[model samples]
Structures are given as C-alpha cells and as structure tokens.
Target: MPRSRMLEYDGAAWHEDCFLCSGCRKPIGSEAFVPDNRRFYCLACYEQQVAPRCSHCRKALTKGGLTYRGEVWHRDCFLCCGCGSALAGQTFTSQGERPYCVRCFSSLYAKKCAACNTPITGFGDGKYVSFEERQWHQPCFKCSRCSVSLIGSGFFPDRDQILCADCNSDD
Candidate 1:
C-alpha cells in the first residue's frame, strides 16, 4: 500500500478546509488550482468563467488576450474600427480608443481639399495629391491660375492657390 504524502507549506501541513474554488464553489479535491487575488480557482473554472474577455468579441480568452488602454482583444478579434478588417501585422491608426486601417483612417479623418472644399476620402481606388498639406482629387489637381490640368508636371502653392511653375514665373 502507498503511504499518503503530506502537503506542507511554510512550517505546517496545508489544510484541506481552504481548498474550494471561488467560481464554482466546489472543493478543489486533488485537481489543479490557481490563486486569484485572495481567492482560489480550479483550472476548469478559471478557464471557463474567470478569464478576461475580448473587448471586440466579448468572449473569454483562455490563455492570453491583447491588452490596450485597459481593454482586451483576441488575436482574431482585433479588427479595424472603421471597415472591420483585420489589423494584425498591418499599418493601422487609433482614434477615440478605436483602431483603424490606414485607408479607413485617411478617408474618415483626413482634411478636405483647399480648392473644392470636399473631404478627400481616399477610399477604394481613389487617389489624392497633396501640396503644402492641401489635398485634391487626381483629376481636380489643376493649376489655380490657368485652370489647366497638372497631372504630371510640377506645380507650386502660392498662398491658397496652386500654380504651375510657368504660371508662378509669370506672376
């Protein structure tokens, strides 16, 4: 017959009266357990009910969760706040405690065109050109003085207007 092994702690044998799981209110028996603050949790109870939840999906994370600004997220639940796309291993931005993909961030938050006074939402395949922080649609990018398209040629910003190098020299 095998002799029962005494579980010792500090200088005394560990008492069995304190071996209950806080979550399930069940005796821990000989099962594995962990300490949470001043309470003890059985392995199953901790994994099922005591773990932190993902902020995006609201599901409990068994092993680990990504923590940001006091919020938690699962690896697959960390999505762009604007378009709901995955942001892992991709360039992203944050606003008001929400993460966003680069395109969604630029489209939803970037400044408007100085000339047209419309939002430069660079969504989908749309493109934008900037001169001195002023943004314009590719087709709308024209010389302010001559109203000529400056798709490829160089242009300069004079105060609130963009002028071709030729127009700037004429001024």
Candidate 2:
C-alpha cells in the first residue's frame, strides 16, 4: 500500500497526489491555488481560464484592474484613446465607447466660445452662456461697445456684436 500526505481545505481532506487542478489536471502540491465552484485550479490555470481579461489588451487581469462601461481593463490598459495616456485616478470622458483625458477631450470635442474663440470646457465649475446657437464664457459675455456684463440683463445683438441697452441707444 502507498502512503501520501494529506491537506485539508474547505473542510475536505485531500491527498496531495489527488489534489489536482481542474483546468490542467495537474497535481496541486502545496502551491497556491484558486477554488471555484468546489473545483481547484493552479495559479497558471486559474489565470488562463478564470481571471478577468482586459478589454483593451485582451490579457488576463490577475491583480488590481479597472472597469468602465461594464468592461474590464488592467490599470496599464485603461488609456486615453486620444492621447494614449494612462487614465487611472484622472478625469476622463468617453466618446463612442473610447476613453479620453480631460485635456484631450476638451481640445477635440468641447465647444468653442463665440466671443473669445476658445474651447469652452465645462469643467472646474466654469459657467457659460448660450445664445442663438452661440456660446460664451461668463466673463466673455459682455457688450462690445461698453464692455458691460450682459448677464441677467437685456442686451441687443447688433451685426455680430452684443451691445448693452444704454450703448445700443447711442449707436
């Protein structure tokens, strides 16, 4: 009769030779293993067959990772589609299922302010005013003649220029 050492796991005693990995059917002799659905697997087999894969690189995510839009990704794989920068712990936006860093997103997609002709990124609590399909930053929304703020007051649109009511009367 042959004798072998035994190990106990999850209240079940398993002979070392009999403790085989469900994936490769190799003996799991004291090495780290993963248990799933009452089946045992070695680290290699578990990583190959059970670990979540990165959506971008299609590699097994054996450690810390990220999830976006219900898809999984490794930390190094969650990159901005625009500039190819890492987006972990950083502000980002998505367009057509791809991720982009804030700076890249603003440059590529944000609306341009009509008065200043600069991108009006709606970040950092910055406010803007939109009028007749044109947009402007709060500070840029002013009368062209007197430079008076037109917010919360009536103004006149005069040939691609905004004029305060007082300034419009003088024109």
Highest TM-score scorer: 2
lDDT by residue (33-77, candidate 2, tens digit) is 999899988999989999888998898888899899998999888
Which parts of model 2 have CA positions greater than 4 angstroms off?
1-6, 9-18
C-alpha local distance difference test of each model: 0.77, 0.89
Clashing pairs in 2: none
Tens-digit lDDT track of model 1 for 133-158: 67788878899988898889988877
Q: Model 1: residues >4 Å from true position, as ranges?
A: 1-4, 8-18, 112-170
Q: Per-prediction TM-score, please? A: 0.56, 0.83
In candidate 1, list every pair of residues with a backbone clash: none
Locate the minimum summed-lDDT window of 10 residues in model 1: 1-10
